[model samples]
Target: MDLMDLSHQNRINTQLSKQKVGKTIYTDCIRAENIKQIVPAITQCIECYPRFHRAENPDICIMVTGIPNVGKSSLINALRRMHLRKGKASRVGGEPGITRSVLSKIQVSENPLIYLLDTPGVLSPRIENVETGMKLALCGTILDHLVGEDIIADYLLYTLNNYPQHRYVQHYELEGPCDNIETLLKEIAKKLRKTQKVTAITGTGKFSEYPDGFLFH
Candidate 1:
């Protein structure tokens, strides 16, 4: 499907033509326009999905890192449906870091060679604040590049809480009830639906009405 088709399918309303922008070749254009609207966000995405270092022959690795149960697996599954491999990345569950020792890599294309890495949830880091900052920066960057700025920020808030002590929360001053991760996931789902232009308050209620195809195109 083209970009427009995907957006229509996902209910994302944007001016960019789906057919023209769907191709990976137009990613730079999307990034340029998006960065103009949200600078820090685009910068973050670039850092997260860094370009191949060696120009002669570079291997691109796109890392998908987020807190547990934040739909990371679901997103990967969706991507896999788009022809990407679902490497043996960690599975989603209440416990963090299920794929502790293994790194799941999905090969998107072979000619240029793109590898998408699903990393372990960022909870208690073996390192310190610096590592957390770097991860948060990369996460923000990736989200902004692919999704949007506000969505990325919201995701960051939801995921960073996975590591209660992560300095990103303090840096952003995100203060709220310390609800469970499930609550945050629901919130993300609700926001995602809204981003797709669905106007439903109770996310569960909307989800329950899936039979009517209320949200799906």
Candidate 2:
């Protein structure tokens, strides 16, 4: 199918580009647009599956699962919009833990008789390493407070430098690429004017208030 061919060529992840897997379909879609493209591919997958093909009208119940904040709910909502011409049945959020529990099935397509189950995001019990966990945390799979934004931001800087992606330097209007997160944060806060006055403890039990730059409002 054209959908499968397009998906196979869409290499979003460099690490997995060479790896081959059977009975799996890859699709890259934006929720606001290209959502209609997903439904046909899904229908094709269901039709190709021998277990579901046995029944003429199979009650196709697809359970969507992935790490938190990877757009599982958003995907369901997009599919619903594309297939059934409906609005959002599943709620979406920027952070993790948006979908609290498994809710009722949402019918996305009528022709293939398909229904989708949106479930809470689950993490693997065994993560490969600290760097892997940090990457997940950076992607917002885990809560920011648990991993700490400072750590994640530092790791991000490291990854960007390692990959040699210097677009941030131009975007931030920096003189050159930065190796220090603190310096970058100060420049960003200065550029965006995201600063707050906070009192600090000084020597000899004295206190002084100074302007502090913060990313969060």
Candidate 3:
């Protein structure tokens, strides 16, 4: 089947799967404006999709990573609808870590070749440290790319020493106690610089640079 057909089938399947044994399942379809907002990002990825599809020397492997409830699944869903205009093959849910193994090599088109790796969400290995959990949560499913060695080290130290609260001192912008999305994006940018430096020297840079203003609305 074509990618569009597969996507449509996936969406239908998802709706069917959500039907409760006794309870009714109500579907609130996505709004047009929301779809419009995510189109550019999806289009940007689509342009690079074909390269990843090529058998050898793929140009880019786009990995959508982010914290739980930060709209990773929603964003992917939007991309699927806008670009593929079909349903999803994989199931999506509110519970964390639903996307457990890597989903490799989904062809957006035959010629260009684009691949997407929808990985399991990042979670705290253990619940012993709340700070560690927060950091893991912040790093999202694609922590390998979103975080760098030095930032990881600093995050580890901060978490281990119970200084996670300090992350908000100057790095984060909180209105009262709630985090501001703009602030989060700024912090991420700063962390990226530190992480890249470490990766350059250590040969561990596998993460891709995120587009500017990605974390903000």
Candidate 4:
């Protein structure tokens, strides 16, 4: 969900484009303004409208599936808006698992009669690796607390460093790239004055203050 930055998204997509995906995955970047291309793309993908030669067959039911928080519902709604000029028929949210179950069919088009089946985002039972899981978490496919924000933030720091994207360092007014998560968090906390006071156990019948802020507030 943090893919709000178009440049960052384009860079990430460029890196992924270098890797292999299936036999030949067609690539296209459609912005919100280019909704016209969506219908053509779907219609051209033979898989989208298979053999329904019968005179009165049920309307084409297209099932949308993906990892959580990838905007499946929004896509359906957008297509509906473009084709049917209708309001949203499915719920859209900024978090994962917005659609809890298989939702009833919603018509998206009138001519060919396209009905979209909105299903809840499904994740594999087991993630391949920690980094893969971290990426999923960073993309909001997984809940933040499940992976721990500190770890995710640190991973973000590492990724930014690996990408040589020091725009953060300039934004935070830091001296330079920092490899230490705690040190970076400390510097950020101090700069933002975002510290929480709480008791910390010293394990010697005593306690100390605990800090509770990170990610530049």
Judging by lDDT against the true structure, name the best candidate. Answer: 2
Candidate numbers sorted by TM-score from highest down: 2, 4, 3, 1
lDDT of each residue in 99-213, candidate 2, tens digit only = 9999999998887778899999999999999999998998889999998988899999999999899999899888999899998888888777776666778887897766452
Residue 93 of model 1, lDDT score: 53
Which has the greatest TM-score? 2
- Ten contiguous residues with the weakest lDDT in model 3: 20-29
Which residues of candidate 4, in runs, are more than 4 Å off?
1-34, 45-50, 196-217
Candidate 1 lands at a TM-score of 0.30
Clashes of each: 5, 0, 13, 0
TM-scores, all models, native as reference: 0.30, 0.77, 0.34, 0.72
Q: Cα lDDT of model 3 overall?
A: 0.49
lDDT of candidate model 4 versus the reference: 0.77
Assess candidate 2 and give its TM-score to the true structure.
0.77
Whose TM-score is higher: candidate 1's or candidate 4's? Answer: 4
Candidate 4 per-residue lDDT, tens place, 77-189, comes to 87787788789899988788789999998898887677889999999999999999999998899988888899999999999899889997889899998999998888888
lDDT of 1 at 78: 42
Over the stretch 1-217, how does candidate 1's per-residue lDDT look in tens digits?
2123354544432333455432121121123342133223323444465463456756556776666434455444444433333442336553334546446576644434555677656654553664464454444322334444445455455566665646633443435534454444444455456323334346555433233233421
Query: What's the true lDDT of residue 117 in model 3?
Result: 60
